[model samples]
Target: MTEIHVRDLRTADPADAAAYAAVRRASVPAMPATAESVAYTCVHAHPDARYRALVAEADGEVVGTAQVGLAHDSPEPGQGYLNVYVHPERTGLGAGSLLVRTAEEFLTHEGATALYTWVLDTPRNRAFAARRGYRASRTAQFLRLDLARAALPPLADPPPGVELRTAADFRDDPRPLFALDAETAADEPSDVPAEFDDYAYWLTETWRHPLLNHELTTVAVVDGEPAAFTLAHTDGDGRYASGMTGTARAHRGRGLAKLAKNASLHRAREAGCTEAFTGNDTENGPMVAINRWFGYEVFDTEVRHVRAVG
Candidate 1:
C-alpha cells in the first residue's frame, strides 16, 4: 500500500469533489452528502468562517476527508472545528491520523485556540480520539425513521390563529426565517457554540443550498407571524433529512415545532422518500422526546471531543 498523504481539496478538479463526497458518504451514511453539495460548500464557504476542506489520498485514491474551520460567529473567540472521517474500509492505514495532524497544524497556524470534533462512540474510535489528547465533552444521537414502514403521528389541523406553510412561500423574503433560525440555533447544545447573526451569510450558505427542499420544508405561522418551522433537505433520491426544527421562544410548549415537523414528514412520505434522519444532543430532552413521538429510533451515537491549542 502507498503512503497516505493529506492535502487541501482541489475544487477545480472534478474528481476531487466526488472523492471527497464518497469518503464522507461512506463514513456517515445517515448524513446528506453529494458531489454537488461538496463543491457548493467549498466555493460558498463563509469568508469569516475561514473554512478548509482536505482529502487524504493513498495509492492515488481518496481514503479520508476533513472539514476544518474557525467559528468566527461564535461569541467565544479562537474556536475551531475539525470533523474528520476515514473510509471504513481504509481505516488503520494512517489516513485518519494524517488528516487530524494536518488539520491541527493548519487550524493552529490560523490562530485557533481550541479545537473540537465529533468522534463515533465506538471503542476504537473513542480510543483514537483519547490517544490524540482530546477530552470527551458531550454526546449526540443520530436517529433514523423508515418513512415507508414506521408509523408517524397523524397530521392535524393547526390550532386557532395558526396556519401551515412551506418554506417556498417565503422565497421573496426569508429574513423572517433568518430571525427564527438564529434565535433557535443559539439555544442548541454544541461543543463549538454557533451564532447565526448574519442574514446575508445565512442566505448564501443555507437558503440557497441545493439539497434544501423549500416545497417540503414546513412552517407554522401563528397570528400572521412565523412561529415554528422544520427545515427539510432531500438528496433528490428516496432519502430525507431534517435540517432543523425549532419553535420561537414565545411559542414554545404549544407543540408548534412538532406540528411543523409532522407536516414536513408527511410531505416527505407523500413525495416517495423512504428514509428520514435527524440528530439531537443527548441533553436535549424536549427535542429527543419530540422525535420519539415521531417514531425516530436512535441508530448511532457520537461524542464531542476537544483539544486545546495555542
Candidate 2:
C-alpha cells in the first residue's frame, strides 16, 4: 500500500523548508529557490491571499509540495494558483496527484472560481496537466546567461533627462518604485492578471525579501521619478536572477528598461555572480528581444494551465 499523505508545511521546522527546497531544485533547476526564501514567503504572505503550503510525505519522507494561494491583487476576483513540485526521483508514487487534490479542496472552500498552474514544457508533464482537466494557456521561457564568460555590451550614456540609480538610493521612500512596478505588471502576459495595490504588503513580501539584492537592483530615473527598474535577487552562491524588469508605460520606447537591466546585470557579474537567469512570456516580444540581445539563451519553457473550480 502506498503511504503517501499530504499535510500542512511546518514553517517552524527547519527540515520542512529544506525538504521543500530540495524538491523544487531537483524538479526544476531553471527555477530559483532557497530554504530561507521559501520559509520567508510562508511567513510573510498577505492574509487576504489565503496562502497555504502543503508537503507530501511517502512513509515519513518528504516527496512533494504545493503552494496554493489566491490572486488577491488581481482586479478580477476568484482566481487562485496551485504550483506543485515533486522530487525528480520520487515521481510515479501518486504524490503529485495527492498534493493537487488536497490543495484544490482547500482552495475551493476559499471560494476560488478558477485555478492556474505551471507545468514544465515536457511531453510527460504537459500530458499530466491535460489529463487533470487543465487546458494549456500562455507559455513562458527561462533564459540563462554565463555572466562570467559572456561579453556584455558597453554601458551607454543615459539620455540627458534620464539617470541610473541602484535600488538602495531610494532608502527613504520606495513608493515611486512601487508605482512603476504596478504600471508595468499590468501589461505582463498571464492567464490571470495581477495588480500591486498593497504598499505595506509589497514592502514586506518583496522589497525586504532576503534574496532581494538592493545594491544590485538598478532603477532608471526620469525627472527624479522612477521610470524603469530591474529588481535583482541573489542566493549568495554566485547565482543571480532578474526577478522583474519592467518599464513604465510613459518610459517604454527610450530603452530605459534595458539600461536598468544592463546596469544591474553588470553589477551582479562584478559581485561574483557566475550565472544569471530571467524569464519572459512568449508573447512579450519586446522583452524577449531584449534578453536575447543580452546574450541570454532560452534553456527551458513552461506552459500555464487553467481549470475552473466549483
Candidate 3:
C-alpha cells in the first residue's frame, strides 16, 4: 500500500530546504525561489504570521510542499494563506490532497475565517481548488523578458530635477524607501489589506533577504527625494526577477516607476543575468502596459482562490 503523509519541514536541515525549493521551482517557475531564500523565510518570518513550512512524503520520498501562514501584516484579522504544490511527475500520489488537508486544519485552528491560495490557471489545477471548496478571485500574469537578447530601451537621462539611484545608495539608511514602499503597496489591489507599519519587521523580512540584489535595484529621485523604485532579486545562476516596482502616490504619472525598472533591467543584464521575470495583477492595466512596452511576454497566469473557514 502506498502511504502519503505530511509533516512540518525541518527548517534547520539544508537538504529539506533544497527539496522544498525544488518542488516549488518545478511547480511555479515564475516565482523565484532558492534553497537559501526558503531557509531565510523559515527563520526570519514574522512571529505573528504563524508561518509553517510543510512537506508531504510518499513512502518517505519528499514530493510536495506548502507554505502556510496567517496574514499577520494585513489590517484584516483572521486572513490566512496556504500555497501547496506537488511535483508535476508525482501528482497522482495523493501528496497534494494530504498537504491541503493538513494545512487547512492548521489554519482553522489558528482562528482563520478566510483562507486564500493561488492556483495555476490550468484545467486540472482549477478543478483541484474547486473540489476543495475554493472560489476563484483575482488573476495575475507571469511575464518573462529575455534580458540577454531583447533590445531594451536605450537609457535616457532622468527628467529635470530627477536623479537615478540604486538601493545600495541607501545603505546607511532605508527608512525613506520603506515609507515609499508602504505607500505604494497600500494602493495595490488585494483581497487582504496590508499595512506596512512595522519597519523592524520590514528590515528583517524584506530588506535583508538573501535573494535581494541591492546593487541592481534601481531607485528614482525627484528633487533629492525618493520617488520610485524597483526591487531586484537574482539567483546567481543568470536568472533575475523584479521583486516589486512602485512609485509614490505623489510621483505617479511621471513615468518614474518605468524609468527605475528600465534602468534596473539594464543593470541586471550588465551584471551577467540572462532571464528576467516579473508578475502583475490582471487588474493593474497601467503597469501591465508598461511591462509589455519593455518586451515582457505573458508566460503563465495564476488565479487567487478563497474559501471561508469555519
Candidate 4:
C-alpha cells in the first residue's frame, strides 16, 4: 500500500524544495527553475495571494509537487491555477492524484470558479489532464537561442534623443517600468486577462524575484520616458531567459521593443550566458517575427487547459 502526504512548501525542508525544483526542471526543461527561485516564490508571494506548494511523499520519499495559486491580479476574480508534476522515476504511486485532489479542494474553498493549467504537448500529459476534466485551449511555444553559436542582430545606436538603460537604474523608483508593464500586460493575449496596475505586487513578485537579473534587463528610454523594456533572468550558469519584452502602445511602431531585447541579449552574452529561452503565444505574430529575427528557434510547445468549477 502507498501512503501519500500533501503539505505546504513553506514548512518543507530545503532539501525537499531542491528535489521539487529538480523534478520540475527535468519535466519541463523549457521553463527555468532553481531551488532559489522556488524558495523565492514561497517567501515573496503576495500576502493576499493564496499560494501553496504541495509535495507528495510516498511512505518515506518525496515524489511529486504542485504549485497552486489564485490569480489575484487579474481583472476577473475567482481565477486559480494548479500545476502538478510527478517525478519521472516515480509515476505510478498515486502521488499525482493525491496532489491534484488537495489542490482542487483548496482552490474550491477559496471561491475559485475556474482553473487553468499548462500541460506539455504529449499524449500522456494530455491524457492525464483530460482524465481530470481539463479541456484544451490555446497553446504557446517555447523558443531557445544558442547564443554561443547564433549570429545576433547587429547592435545599432539608439535613435536621436533615445537612451538605453538597465533595470538596475530604477531600483529606487520602478514606478515608470510598472506603468509600462501594466499597459503592455493589458494588451497580451491570454485566456484570463491580467491588470497589473498594482505596484506593490509587482515589486514583491516580479522585481524582487531571485532569477531576475536587473543589470541585464535593458530598457529603452525616449525623451526621458520609458518606451520599452526587456526583462532578463539568469541562473548564473550559462542559461539566460527573456522573462518579458514589451513596448508601450503609443511606441509600438518605432522598433524600440527589438532594440531593448537585442541590447539585453548582447549584455547577457557578455556576462557569460550561452543559452537563451523565451515563450510566446502562438498567435502573437509580431513577437514571433521579432524573435526569429534574433535567431531564436521553437524548441517546445505547451497547451493551456481550462476547467470550469462552480
Q: TM-score for all predictions?
A: 0.98, 0.97, 0.98, 0.95
Candidate 2 ranges with C-alpha deviation above 4 Å: none
Q: Return the lDDT, model 2, position 107.
A: 89
In model 1, which residue pairs have backbone atoms overlapping below 3 Å?
A: none
| Candidate 4 lDDT, 1-310, residue by residue in tens | 9888877775346787787787787777767788889888987777656999888888867788898999888879999999888888888888988888999999999999999888889898899899999999999999999998879998999999889999999999999999998899888889999888778879988999989999999999988889999999898779999888899998898899999999999988988999999999999888999999999999988999999998
251: Cα error in model 3, Å: 0.8
User: Where does candidate 2 clash, by residue pair?
Assistant: none
Ranking by lDDT: 3, 1, 2, 4
Task: List model 1 lDDT by residue over 131-239, tens digit each.
Answer: 9999999999999999999888888999999999999999999999999999999989876678888898899888999889999998999887899999998987798
For 214-261, candidate 3 gives per-residue lDDT tens digits of: 999999998878999999999888889999899998889999999999
Model 3 regions lying over 4 Å from their true place: none
Model 4, runs deviating above 4 Å? none
- In order, the Cα lDDT scores of the candidates are 0.91, 0.90, 0.92, 0.88
Residue 289 in candidate 2, Cα distance off native in Å: 0.5
Pairs of residues clashing in candidate 4: none
TM-score of 2: 0.97
What tens digits encode model 2's per-residue C-alpha lDDT throughout 1-310?
Answer: 7799999889898888888888887887666678898899999988988999899999999999899999999989999899999898998999999998888889899999999999989998888899889999999998999999989988888989999999899889988888888888889987888888888888998899988999999999999999999999898778898889999887788899899899888888888999999999999999999999999998789999999978
* Candidate 2 to native Cα RMSD, angstroms: 1.2
- Please say which candidate is ahead in TM-score: 2 or 3: 3
lDDT of 1 at 212: 93
